[model samples]
Target: MSRVLVTGAASGLGEALSAAFEARGDEVLRTDVSYERGFETGASAPSSTSGGYRLDITSDDDWAAALAHVESTWGGLDVLVNNAGVAGGGRLDVATMDEWQWITEINLFGAVRGTRTFVPMFKRQRSGRIVNTASLAGLVHPAGMASYNASKAAVVALTETTGHELAAYGVTAHVVCPSYFRTSLMSSLRGADTALAEVMSKLVDESPVSADDIAAAVLEGLDRGDELIVPDQAARDAHALKQTDRATYDVVMRAQAVKLEEGAR
Candidate 1:
């Protein structure tokens, strides 16, 4: 059993992962921006095996404190899952500067900081895994999701680079590029610009996957030491499109954009 640290563990994929790891007898440290009432209601943070804490992934000081706490208590961390992210919708031209900055700060920079902080710890142990949560958007350009797609694409690139850099230290990195999963992620998208929110709603209605499936894919990828894990059929297809032909890929994406625009109307 591994000592695992998962960010964004309060809900969605992060919560699912924490539960799955704990069920498998791993010592799991779950952290998020806030604690769910269910976990906090009369449930004391565990001392030995399972635990939870509040963590703001955007804050470097918060990241430092959380890592220090985990290292002090667990002695070492065997797995680090950077799963915290925010969704940004709408066309690039219409997206506000604040929106772009916010998404990049958390979705991209958060992963960067997590990898930078725990890499040395993993190197010391010389046996560890880093799982970065990217998305199918990272592999393909999706209409009206420029910020989200760009941030995840950065994660994919970072994971590939870090995987090679950490290989000599006996550490491996896995990038999870999952398709749309049924979760609060969709609801969260509602917080985006009004027009974009409507578009996101239709996309969510069309997607056919769940957060649990994504959680399973993550574990499977780690077990197999796979660099890229596309959790669902849609994600696999998206990745394949990129492999097939650049011109064909562009044509497909453009068709998708037209479809989304027509649907929104």
Candidate 2:
């Protein structure tokens, strides 16, 4: 089995991913900012894993500690899953500078930090995988999600570039661009637009898919060596519509935009 490290493992997609990797007999080191916050805020932390540690992706020190832990505990690494992120969005002029910075720092820079820290180890081993969790918004770019969409889209680009740059060294990079599914990700949602937030919340709550379903598809995609994994039918359909029918795509997108405008009013 592989030796895997997952960030944001306390809840949501990260929790599901950690379980999925463990179910496949891989040794997983789960980390999350929540784990750190538990100590800082005096809240109850989640059940401890054998090698799990508190990691705040925004901190370089935390990233360094994680790498040290992996080396000391596993002796080698196989997969690095950069899955920690917050849910955030706002319409163009409404999004605050602080919100943009917050979303970008975690959603985009968190992955970047993790990948950078682990790349040296992977390069030395000459075999490793980087799995980044982006979102369908990264590709589809719907309305009222400027910050979130930009952050996720940057992740997509980072993964693609890493895949190309690391291929010769036997390293592969994969990005999961999943649509809204039942996940505690909404718990971390933040934005200046309350209306947009509610709309996103409804979409997430009403989705027919679950985190487990996405995790399973992610593993299957990894097994197949897929670089881009769009696991859900909804995401696939949306992306396909964008690619094959631009006019129809614009109509649907604009209609959603109109609804957001109405909601904000």
Best candidate per lDDT, number? 2
On a 0 to 1 TM-score scale, where does candidate 1 land against the true structure?
Answer: 0.90
In order, what lDDT does every prediction score? 0.80, 0.90
On the 0 to 100 scale, the lDDT of residue 106 in model 1 is: 87
Looking at model 2, residue 191 earns an lDDT score of 77
TM-score for each predicted model, relative to the true structure:
0.90, 0.95
lDDT of 2 by residue, 1-265 (tens): 8888899998889999999998888888788886644222322322235435689999998888778767765777999999999999989989899999999999999999999999999999999999999999899999989899999999999999999999999999999999999999999988779999999899899999999999999999999999999999999999999999999999999999999999889
Backbone clash numbers for all candidates listed? 0, 0
Native RMSD of candidate 2 (Å): 3.3
- Lowest summed lDDT window (length 10), candidate 2: 38-47
lDDT of 1: 0.80
State how far residue 10 of model 2 sits from its true place (Å).
0.7
lDDT of 1 by residue, 1-265 (tens): 8888898887889988888788779888788888543233324433224456767788787778766776766678899999988777677666788888888988999999999988888999998999999888898877878888899999999999998998999999999888877767764552345676776666666767778778887888778879998888888987887888878988887887787667656
State in Å the error of residue 225, model 2: 0.4
